[model samples]
Structure formats: C-alpha cells, structure tokens
Target: MDLPAPDRLAEVLRQRFGLDAFRPGQQAAIEALFAHRRLLCIQPTGYGKSLLYQLPATLLPGLTLVISPLLALVRDQVGQLGARFDIPAASINSDQDDDENARAMAGATEGRVKILFVSPERLDNLEAWRFLLGLPIDLVVVDEAHCISTWGHDFRPSYRQIVRAVRTLAERRPSVRVLGLTATANARTEADIARQLAPDEATPLRVMRAAMDRPNLSLATVEAAGAPAKLAWLERFVAQSPGNGVLYCATRDQTAIVAGYLAQRGLEVAAYHAGLDPAAKRRLQREFLDGRWRAIAATNALGMGIDKSDLRFIVHVDVPGSITAYYQEVGRAGRDGLPARGVLLYDPADRRIQTHFIRSAQPTPEDFERVLAVIAPDADGAWPNLTRIRVRSGLHPTRVTVVLAELREQGHVEKVLIDRKQVYRRVQGTDTPLDLTRYTRQDAVRRAELDAMIRYAEGAVPCLMQALRRALGDDDAPACGRCDRCAPPAWADLPPVEANEGVAGWLLHRDVEIAGSRRPPMSAGLALLDGQLRAPPFIDFMRRRTQPGASLAPAVIDLLRRQLDALARRHTFEAVLPLPSRTWAQRDAVAALAAEHLGVPWGADALAWRDAPDARQGELLNNDQRRQNVRGRMGAALPGATEGALLLLDDYVGSGATLAEAARAVRVAGHGGDVVPLTIAKVRWRLGARGIV
Candidate 1:
C-alpha cells in the first residue's frame, strides 16, 4: 500500500489546504496514512496531529473516520479541516441533536463528508457499528490515543473499546488503515497504547515520534504556605506577568476561588470548568481566546481542544496526578515557538487531594453487585435491558455502562438485543464471580505515580524539565536549562501562610421556607443528587433506614442529631410531628429519636401516606415526575397553635410533594402558626413556580 504519488499528495496540500509543506514528522505520518499503515504517532502538541489524516483524506476516495475523546476536540478539528480544505466535515457526539447526527451520517453515506468525527464511546452501540460498516471508511484515526492505555494518566475505558470498532471495520474494509495520535506518551504508555489500538492487525505497526523537548517553555514550582497566601501569590504572579495565560486547577471550586481572587484585584479573569453548561464553557473559552479576559482559571477540561499558538503561560494551582497529564497541560503554552512559563504552586497538603481523586475513581465490588442486582431476568430467563433497568436502579447511566463492561469482561454476563435495545444478563450456568482485583492493582500504580508527581512539584531534581522527562521514562530527555530550576525567578520567596488561610467552615444556619403553601417548612440532607438510584452508602442507607430490622450508620445518626439540634436552636421548636413512613416501622427515622433527645414531645403518626404508588422516588428523572411520585400521598394531623414553630419531620424529603400536601392537610385541619419541616436527608424537591429542584 502506497500513497498517491508525491506530486499528487503535495498538490492537494498546496491547492486545497493553502499549505505546501508538512512539519517535521507530519509528512511521514501523511504518507503512512495513505499507505494504510498501522501507525502510532506520538507527536508533541502543536505539531499538527490533526493535519496528518486531514491531508490524506483529500487524496483518498472514501471517508476518514476519527474517534475523538472530547466534543471540543472534534469541533475544533472539524472546523480547521473545513476551513482549510473547504470540504464537507461533520461530527456526531452525545451533545448533538438527532437530526444533526443523522445529517452527519447521511453525509458520510453519500460520500460528501471526507472526514467524520465520532465519540469513542459510540463503539458501545452495535447499531451504530453496523451502520458505519456500510460506509466506505478507508482510514480510522483514534485521536488522543493515550486514553486507550489504562496505565496512561488520562485513561478512558471508552477509548479502549474503539479498538474493537476499528478491528470490526478493518474486517469489512481490509485496507482501512488505523492511526492513533497523542501528544503525551512515555515508553511504557506508548507500548500499551500501540498494543490496544490495533491488537488484531496482521501488519506490524510503525510509530512516529517527534522530540519530547520544547525549548521555549520554562517550569517553576512555588511553595505557598496555605490557601490565602496561595491566593495572594496567584494575584501577584499574574500582576507581574506579561501576556494572557490559563491557571490550571484540579477542581472547579478551586478555579472559582482563584478566579475570584484575581478578579477582586481588578484583573480581567473568568472561571472555566466542565460542570458548566456547554454554552457557558463555549462562551468563556471564546472570551479568553478573544483577549477579553487576562486569564481563565480552569480544570484539566480546558487542556485538550484549545489550540492557542501564543499562550504565554500555563500555571497550576494544585499538582496533577501524573507526569504525562502534567506535560499535556503545559504543552498548550509556547506553541508559537516563543518562550512560555508553566508554574506550579503547592502546599505539601495538596497531595492529599490528588490521592483522594485517584482513590475515588476505582469502583468497589459493592457498586458492581448493587447495579447488577437491579436488572431482573425477563420471561424465558433473558437479561433485562439497561434503559428500563436505569429507572429501577438509581445509578448514573455511565456508571451502569462501566459496571456492565466490567461484568462482561469477567465472563459473568453477556449482552443481547431485545427488540433492538441492548440488554444484559448473567452468562448461563458459568456462575463466574465478578473480579475487582484489577482495580486494586491499578490503584496501587496510580498512587506511586502520584508520589512521582509530588516529587516533581517538590523539585527533587535540579532541573524541572529533566525531572519530568525522567519521570515519564524519557531516558534521553535533556535538561532544558531554561526553567526556574536552572535560574530562580526574581520573587522566589512567597509570603508566609496567613493565620486564617482557609475559608471559614459553613454552618447549618438556614431555614427552609415553602411559599404559597400551608406545609411546614423543611430541612433535608446535606446535598441534593439527580433523582436517580445510586449505590450504597446512598441507596444502601436509604433501604436500611426505611426498612424494618436494619441498623443505621453511626455517622448518619450523628448528622441527623446535629441538624435537629441546630434547627431546634434556630427556631426553638416545642413539639415534633414525624411524617408517617409508608410502613409503621421505619427503623432508620431519626426524627422521633432526635426530638426525644431534645426533650420535645413527638408523635410518629402526625403525617400519613394516603395510598402512594409502589415505585420508589429514585425512579423519577426530574421534578415533575418526582411531584407525581408522592402527590396526595400524605395527610397531616392538626395541633393547637403555639408561639414557637411546629416541626414536621421525615427521614428523607423528596420533591416536597408529601410535605406540601401534608401542610395542606394540617391547614385544612385548622392548625395555625409557622409549620417547620425537617428531614434527615433532603432529596430532590421542586418548589412551585420555580425550577429549583
């Protein structure tokens, strides 16, 4: 397999893309792309990874399919390709509308789209895979290919599955070349990535790698005593800096804090994180790029898709988990071959946060079993579908997908199509138990990597660049001699930690008021979750507390007691009326016990359910369905008016329909005075005429 003659490829590059040359290794990559080569390209950032396949697709007759990890990346690459060659370029992602996705697929089918971007997770859809099989796809590029390696710091299991889709496509279209591109990969990660991308290919893979060193970039580590001092130093750093930059944070909360600090100091800045709605993210990204803001404080979510050539700096408020991830984040800087600085500010305590994140990512065995238990076998003993099972089980759809994938790999389950929807069930008679030891093994490896990252931040070696390179297993990586380690900055000594460096603790100080209704005001759980069933200690606590003969956690009891004491002190409640449980025995209801502790007389039957539905509250998606779940399902008994507010209590208050209806019942029963409502946990509750659920 060979590319179209050099003249032909060169002509398309010049005439269509307005470019007559390929950067260093890009030409070899483009030639490989045309040769149907099984290629692994470990190029540095801004080396034009997108153009490798984009250029070859123009010379080919069929579609060049791309599996990218993020929607932003797909959008940017597609936009660039369209602008350069003026061809039909489209992408399908989770965020796109049905018609949009259909149009993209239609373009591919009609041979109008030369390049199509797809989310890596699309491989999970058998139907989508089958549909893509009909297209004349000559090249499949797994962009951000490092994500396929579990050992890689940015590992995504979905990216690992793209290999299967590539293999299937290769089976149908034998000449379909597979190209995996990533800016960050060490020797170990590179091997792992290569093995995962085209494991079944008969042709041996060729790897194209550019030098890892970026000469114009400088690195520094700042040791701030604490949070307040850190904020002060951050303001100082930006004040003294020359051009616009991005400050990387490990979490969105940190981003807000840092962004606010800089804004308060009269610096133009904005916060960006993944939690924001798509429009907000897009707006902030554009604003910063357009030079409206001096800096944008963000989490790693801003790293991959952005392609600013002259981004003078990339600073980190907290240490990242691995050298690979750190390199990728800093690579955004100095893309125009000018000097840029990557600074890391940290306290020794910051390591704990990264450790917590690494630990939290590994799911427990209980999580697996809890999700699997919800999918009941259907008639003829077939496995149940996941969509219907989601409503029954209060878990995120992603969590379910991850768990199912794990189960399938363990040989404990199999997937089948029932009426065109994907379903899963236990593999018959094999009775293989689910294994979670691999997660434990991975956790150990990640912890070691975190230690390595900590060492890098601590400046364990003289040169930061060389230290990072060595940590990533780049033995030949040279010392840049341009970073702070080579020559310290002018203001090296940061201010000491402020006495009150941390923010003040948040107190349980608020009173819940429901307007336009006669219901008692409410108290609820510390946080609200999307109305869905999640595993224990969430659902586990719920079931144990609501059911008879099940004991409660000491922490749950303590939290309820603290809330009750706080509310009593705030409102000076005299009498307590407990919302009646669906059953007489709600062993977990702490309202009765807490009121007794407060020496306030309590009645368990003050509010009663009036023939509620059997379905649990977790099955509902939003406030509307939630209100219906407990509508007209409760009645409140009347009590004489008292000076202090009366307390109406339930173990868990969801949607407030039961409580609101009970308040109506109490009003109808001729009780007056402010009705106070309290629940051990406040689940999602919709207030009337407002969308605060």
Candidate 2:
C-alpha cells in the first residue's frame, strides 16, 4: 500500500473533505493506517475521528469495510461521505431493506463503493460473510472500537467476532489494514482492543492517544433526592437554558416520564429509546438536528451518530453505569467549542438501576446451560427452530440472541440457514466448557465501573474533568479551572427545587401499559413495589391491607375510577372479575372496588385457580416459564356474558402471563365478550424483562 504523498493528500483533503489541514492527531492516525500498522485511535468526541477512515477510504484502492455498532452511526457516516464529499459510500444494516443491502454489497463487489459500513451483528450473518468474502476489502474500520473490548463499559458480544472476521478477511487480502476508533477507552480497554485486533505480535499495533480534556463544558452534580425534586430541577433548568440539549435517562420508561414532564411544562421535547421504531428514532434525530426540538429525553441509544454541535446542555436524570459512558454522552455537548453544561442529578439510590443493568448483561452459567440444552440436535439430525429454542429454553428473545451468539463464538454452536430460516446447530462432539472466568472478570470490571461513576457523582473527586480523564486512562490530566470543583457555576447555587401539583400528578397518576397485551393491559400504577424514583404510595398502602370489603385510599380509588371511566367511555362493562390469586388476598377487594366504582356487578368468584401455581409469576425467569406455570391452572366461573365486556382485574401484572392465562380461561368457557385485563401496577425492568404475547 503506497502512502499518498503530502501534496496529493493535501489536494484530496482540500477537494474531497474541504478541510485545509488535519485535526491534531488525524494526520498521524491516517499515516499509520497507510503504513499498514494495526491502529487504535482514542480521541474525545467531536475530534473528527471519522475523517481518519473517510479520508483513507477515499484514497485507498479497495473497499473500506467499516464495522460500526449503531445503525444511526453507519447511516450518518454514509450520508456524510456521499453528500459532503460525493464519495461513493453505502451501508448495509437491519434498518435498510434487503434490496438496498444487496445493492450496497453489489456495489462493493463491483469496486464502485469506496466505503461500506455495516454493524457487527450484520457481520454475524452467513450471507453477509459470503458477500464480504468476495469483496476486495482493503481496510476494516471498527468504529466505536471500545465495544470490542470486554474491559470497556459497553462491551458487546457481537463485537468479539469482528477480530475473527478481520483475520479471515486478511487471509484473502493479506495487505488489509485495520483501524479501531473510539472516544472512550481506558487503559485496560485499550490494551484489550489492541490484543484482540492484533493477536499476532509480528504485526505490532500502534496506539495514538490525543488530549481528551474539554474546557468549554462545565461539569457538576446536583443533589436531587427524589423523582419530583429531580423533575422540578429539570423543568427549571431547561426553561433557563437556551439551546437544544439532551436529557439522558437510565431506562426507556424514564425517558417518557421526563419528556412528559418537560413537554407538559410547555417545552418542545421528545423521548428517544431503542424501543421506538426505526423511523421514529430517525425522525427525532433529524428534527433535533434541524433545531426543531428544544431538547430530547433519551437513553444511550441516542448517543451515537448525533452530529449537532450547538447543544448547550446535557443533563442526566440517572447516573450512567460508568464514567466512560458519562464522558462519551456528555461529550456530545460543547462540540462547537461554545459554553455548555453537563449536570448529573445525583441520588444514591440510582445506583441500584445501574447495578441491575450490569448483572443482567452477564448471563449466568445456568442461563447458558438452559439455552444449550434446547439447541441440541433433533432425531432427524437437525437443530430445533429458533422459536422453539426460545420457548423451550424459557429465555427472553434478546437473551437467547446473546447466548446463541456466545455459543457460536465458543464453537459449541453454529448458525446455518435451512429452508431460508436461520437457526443454530450444535457443533458435533464439541466439549468446550463455558468460559466462567471471563464472565466473572467482566462482571467485576462492570461493577467497578459503576462504583467509579458513583464516586464521581458523589463529588468525591475534586476535579470533574480530571476524574473523567483519569478514568479514561489519562493519569496525569490537569484539572479544568472551569469545573464546579475549581469554579462553581452559577447554576450550582440555585435554590432547592420545590415539588408542585404537576410534579405530584406526573409521578402518581401516570399509568403504565401492561406491555405484551393483545389489548395492551392498563395499569393504574407504575409498580406495585416502590423503587428509588417511582413511588405510587396508593399501591403500597392497598397491597399491605385489603380485605374483600376494605375501604380504599382516595388516590387509589380515584385512579381506579379514572381508568374505569375511560374504559366505560370506550366500551361497556357487564361484570368485573378478579383474576384469582392464591397468595395475594387484595385482588378481590380491588376488583370489587373497581366494579362498584364503574357501577358494574362484582363477580368475585368469576375466575378460580384450578391449582396453586408452583411459584409466583415474578419468581419465574422468562416468559415461557411464567406462561407454563399458569397454563391450564386457571378455570373461569363466568356465566355467559352475551352483551358487554368482562373486566378482568389483578392487583399487579409482571410477566403478564397470569392475566393472559385467566383471560384465555374465560374465552375457553365460551364467554363471547371482550375481556379487558387491568392491573393496579405493571412491572418494569431496565433489562432482562419482556412481555408475553
């Protein structure tokens, strides 16, 4: 590979990228790639890391296959490459149609496309591998390369296969150049990335580290004890701020909650998460970039591919799992070198949410074995269907995907397309033991990262930027004189936020949709149990002491009445039936109250448990297990309700299998009426929880 002369490089930079000169470390990184050395470039956000590959792809002879993590990032890069520079670039991802992906691959094979971006998950596909094998791949760029390392805060199992893919590609194209780029990589993460990218010491990897301190952004943590207080702070803060910003939340539900509070306050804000459809996410991103939105309350899903530079603030309603995530996310702000602020609304209990995220991501040995047991080949010498594996293993679809990928990587399983359907097949005579040590170490690293984040949020570190820099492997980073520790910002001195009726209503009255319902079950409360942020006290009070005729709290009764009124407006109800529960005695009382409130007959014995469930719904690990636990275990006592709908009520809905089973029982009893499932509280989790359809 001939290195482009400085004059030609300058000409290409001027003509194609419209840049006079490279950013501080960009030229060196580009030169290293041309020198055919394995490269890992760790620079802060907004440092133009994309230029390293974009420029090289322009000059490189063969295809530059960029393995990106997020589809948004891939699309943004491809768009910029084509629109700004008129570069022949394209991307293949899940978001794209099959025909589009096919054209992109065809373009690469025909040597028309210079840069082709794809996700690591896309690389895992056998069809994609065949396409890649045929292309004359010159460069492999691992964007957001920190994900390839287990030591990184956001380690993805799919990324682990990229190294092998690159190695295989190298076998055909021996002169292939590799570059790994990311904004956040600590010492361990960087080392892991280097080791994984360049396993053989013969071709040494070059490390380029740039100064990561950002002085234009102010950092601080404000103590907001509860959801109401935090929300009040957000409301006041957003009103005072001028430019578009991002309010980061821990979960998808919180995004809606925070965005609702802000929007209700007459601010133009929208919530963003992975749960939203692809088009919705794209619309939000485009609108935010077009300066149509004042702010966006989003999860980390909105972190990548965001190019807006005038963001004035970045607020965290919940503490992120690590300093790496915090720095990368907050780094999105002040990219235009203007004054911006990043604030973490601090509360100690928020750590529980982060802890749960860490634990859930690391599947246990039992989880692996359960998935393994289901993937064993059938008598016809074929593996079970993917859906069968999911059902028989009793793992959530997402978990099954992760475990299957890991199993494939460990050589215990492989994906083969049969009858145009992708399914996992057991590797014959493979006796590879589960890599428990690696899993254990990864869990430790994640927990430690969470602890570091907590310490930073608690103000244990004197200089916020210095702490962040050191956490990202900068040991000798000097303190930014503009931080709160050095110079407390004016906003830090604001008075305590007072909770108002709006905040109280947003916290208390917001209903949770029982997810995975055929009719989308309605719930009056967020959860029957209280967490650090959500506190619907009415639920707690009623669950503790409620008999068949117990008087209900006004808040609880008001909420139930409101839900019932809404249902009545939509459809008439003939009877209210309490889904039978052996443990919780409050369901009949709650249902009876609901029936009385709605002026409907209370059928206390309409639903009966044929036998006691082996365990509570919450005790079950996955959807299939929960469904099986209640299957054929409930019998309905409903007399033929020929005219109006039947209101089936429960105190709490968690996997939602119990209510579904009970509804099925009523339907099986030949009741020709709509059975609407309603619950007092709907269970929500940050991870490892999904609804059963």
- Per lDDT, the best of the predicted structures is 2
Query: What TM-score, computed on C-alpha atoms, does each candidate reach?
Result: 0.72, 0.83
Note each model's CA RMSD in angstroms: 10.1, 5.1
Indicate the TM-score of model 1.
Answer: 0.72
Error of 2 at 208 (Å): 1.1
Candidates' C-alpha lDDT:
0.70, 0.79
Candidate 2 structure quality by residue, lDDT tens digits, 362-433: 777888999888887777777776676866776656667768878888899888888766778788898867
The regions of model 1 sitting more than 4 angstroms off are 199-202, 365-367, 378-401, 416-420, 431-437, 489-693
Give the C-alpha lDDT of model 2. Answer: 0.79
lDDT of 1 by residue, 192-236 (tens): 877766546565677877777778888888787566667777776
Clashes of each: 12, 0
